[model samples]
Target: MTKTVEFYFDLGSPTTYLAHTQLAKICADTQSELIYIPMLLGGVFKATGNASPAVIPAKGRYMFQDLDRFAKRYGVQLRFNPHFPINTLILMRAATGIQLHQPQRFAEFVDCLFRALWVEGRNLNDPQTIAAVLTENGFDPEEVLALSNDESVKAKLKENTEAAIKRGVFGAPSMFIGDQLFFGQDRLDFVEEALRQD
Candidate 1:
């Protein structure tokens, strides 16, 4: 039997970016399939009555410090974006569109956007900047912009967010191994253990 890990994420999240970088290897090592479910983190928070830790001054500071430690441990570099709180609506929509229509390019889209938002610290909120990034990544900015506006893609993103809330997802970087939900990049060890169990 093949195990599957459902990863619910948003590009706006640095922690989710960390999980994105790690989950593939974990799934490969465990002989599990990693499924990426793109859902708006803000939508998840609204549905779950939760707010980002960044809303809390002390927690926000501590979270960044802790994330730095994790990056070191994971051997991945993450420079917090100065332009955070980026409106990821279009970005997440682009992701949903890629996953739905261009499955093979799904990882590429994820990698590009994640690095743009988290690593390269690009100001993704600027339309021209986003378009340039997409074009530089070998994607047609206009085509993806069209897809982001597609009715099906918009609905799919909303549906995914609703389903995530129904499944008890309160935030991004939530992983489900079977019916067990693990929230946060910090809980990935538990996710790996869950995958190893079956």
Candidate 2:
């Protein structure tokens, strides 16, 4: 039987970006279904009393170097965005709207957005930049951006964040295989192992 993996992530997370790149291959190899669940990391942290590693002095100092090493190891491009840790409310709402209205397009938008943020150092929080990114990805920029401001979309994003907290998720790049919660990009190997279990 094929297992189902739930991936909860936020674009604001560089670690999540790294994990996202490898997750598809893991799922394909293991014949598990990958369910992408985007939620606001800030909200998750707030509800779960969790803090970002970057907020810790030592970890914050080490994160950039670690990301560099990890990026090189994964053979993925990683660029530091000048606007690191920008507000992701609009982006999260946009994602929720896309998922609600067009699931396939939502996936495409997420892929492009992640590449833009983590690879190209583009400012995803900028409206013009986001619109351009969407347009370049063959999406209707105006339509998608409009959804970013939709009340229902905003509500859904909030709901998703709450759901993550209720699921005991304290951070981004978390994955659930059955009742087991694997936190952080580094824990992905554990997730893969869980998928292999009988």
Candidate 3:
């Protein structure tokens, strides 16, 4: 049986970047289909009474070191973008729009965006930067940007975020196998286990 897993993500999250970096292997091993669900983490947090890990004193302190260790262990480059906690609304909307228009292009664009933010310290909120990233990824930047602001695309982004909140998603990189929700990059092992059982 082919298992289907829903991946809820927001680009502002480092953990989401981490999960994106590692999920391909798990999907290959388990033969599970990944249903990409992009949502605004800010909306999820507001609706679910949740906050970022960086807001917690203890966890905030540990997260930096944890990210470093995880990066080294996974051999993934990790650059702390000066624009930490970036305004991801536009990015998420653009991504959703791209996915709606061109699925394959969406994946490539996302990979580039993630690397730009988490591996190269790029400012994702800037239009020029995002355009450069998309262009470098072989996407037509102007077309994607045009669709990004379309009413329908904007509506999808809003709907996705609202649905995520209603689904009890309070953070980034959350995976859902049916109704079982696994939060965090560390919880991906559990997500794989759930897929195995399925």
Highest TM-score, which number?
1
lDDT of 2 by residue, 80-193 (tens): 677887688888888888899899777788899899999899987788998888888898888987998899888888888888888889998889897889988877789889
Name the 10 consecutive residues with the lowest summed lDDT in model 3.
Answer: 101-110
Q: Indicate the worst ten consecutive residues by lDDT in candidate 1.
A: 189-198
Q: Write the per-residue lDDT of candidate 3 for residues 76-174, one digit (tens) a residue.
A: 999878888799888888899989988877788789889999998999888898888888878887888788888999899889888887887888888
| Leading candidate by lDDT | 1
Q: What is the TM-score of each candidate against the true structure?
A: 0.99, 0.94, 0.94
Q: How many backbone clashes does candidate 3 have?
A: 0
lDDT of 3 at 61: 74
Query: What is the C-alpha local distance difference test score of each model?
Result: 0.93, 0.87, 0.87
Q: Candidate 3: give the clashing pairs.
A: none
Give model 2's clash tally: 0
